[model samples]
Target: MNTVEWSDALLLDYEPMDTVHREFVDLLAAAQNASDAALPQTWAAVVAHTVRHFGHEDEWMQRTGFASADNHIMQHRVVLNLLREGLAMAQAGQMDPVREMAGELAAWFAKHTQTLDAALALHMRREPPPVATVHRPRGGRGAHASPG
Candidate 1:
C-alpha cells in the first residue's frame, strides 16, 4: 500500500495546491515501493518535486500575506533539509534512512496538509487578486506549474 493515499479528505479545494500535493503523495509512494536499484533516483525525484512544491507554497503565502508565512516556510526548509540528508544517505547505500523518512513524511504530510496548507488555501480564497502577475519559476521535476 502507498504510504500516503489521496482522498477527498486531503482536498484543500485549491486546485493548484491540491494538484501539487497529490503529486507529492504519488512520488512518496514511488519512493517507498522502488526497487533497491531504483530507490536513489526515486528519492531524488521526490526531493526535486518538494523543492518546487515548497517554493510554490512559499510564494503563495508571500503573495497572499499568510499570517504564519515565516513559520510555514521554516517548516518547509527544515523538512527539505531532512529529505536532502536522507537522499545523501541513500546515495551512500543507506536505504533504511530513506525508507524511514518516507514513512515519517507520510504522517507529517497528513497533518501539515490539513492544518497549514488548508489555512493557506482558505487565505488564498479570501485574498484579492494581485495587481500584477506573480512570476513563478517553472514547475519542479515531474509537475506542471500554475499561477499563484
Candidate 2:
C-alpha cells in the first residue's frame, strides 16, 4: 500500500488551502496502494478531487490577480488531462496504469507543492487573510478526508 504522511513543510501558509492539498496527498497514497477491490471507485475519486483542487486554486489565483495564474492553470490542465487518461484506463480494468500514474502524480505534486505552490502560499500569507469558505462542492472527483 502506498503510504502518505504530512508535515509542516507542506503547508503553504494558508490553513484551508494547505488542508486540501494535504488531503490530496493522502488520497494519492491511498489510491496508489489500494487493493483491486477498491481500485475503480478510488481511482475515479482521486482524479475528480485533483480536478476540483486545481479549480479551487485557480479561482483563488484569479480572485487575487496572481501574476503567475496563467502558468499555474496550464500546469493544472496538463496534469488533470494526464490523470483523466489514467482514470480512463483504470475504469477499463487496467490497474497497472493507475499505479504508475499515482506514483508520477505523487512525485510531481511533492516537488510542485514545495516550490510553486509554496511560493504562492507564502505570498498569500503575506496578504490579509481572505474570507473564503471552503466546502467540498458537487461534481468534483469524489474522495474523502477526515476534513484535513
Candidate number with greatest TM-score: 1
User: How well is each residue in 24-68 modelled by candidate 1, as lDDT tens digits?
Assistant: 999998999998789999999999999999999999898777899
**Weakest lDDT window of 10 consecutive positions for candidate 1:** 136-145
Supply the TM-score for candidate 2. 0.80
User: Candidate 1: misplaced stretches above 4 Å?
Assistant: 131-148
Q: Candidate 2, residues 29-123: lDDT per residue as tens digits?
A: 77877897688788888888997899988887888888788888899999999988887888788998778778777778878898778877876
Pairs that collide, model 2 = 48-141, 49-141
TM-score of 1: 0.85
What residue pairs clash in candidate 1, if any at all? none
Best by lDDT: 1
lDDT of each: 0.91, 0.80
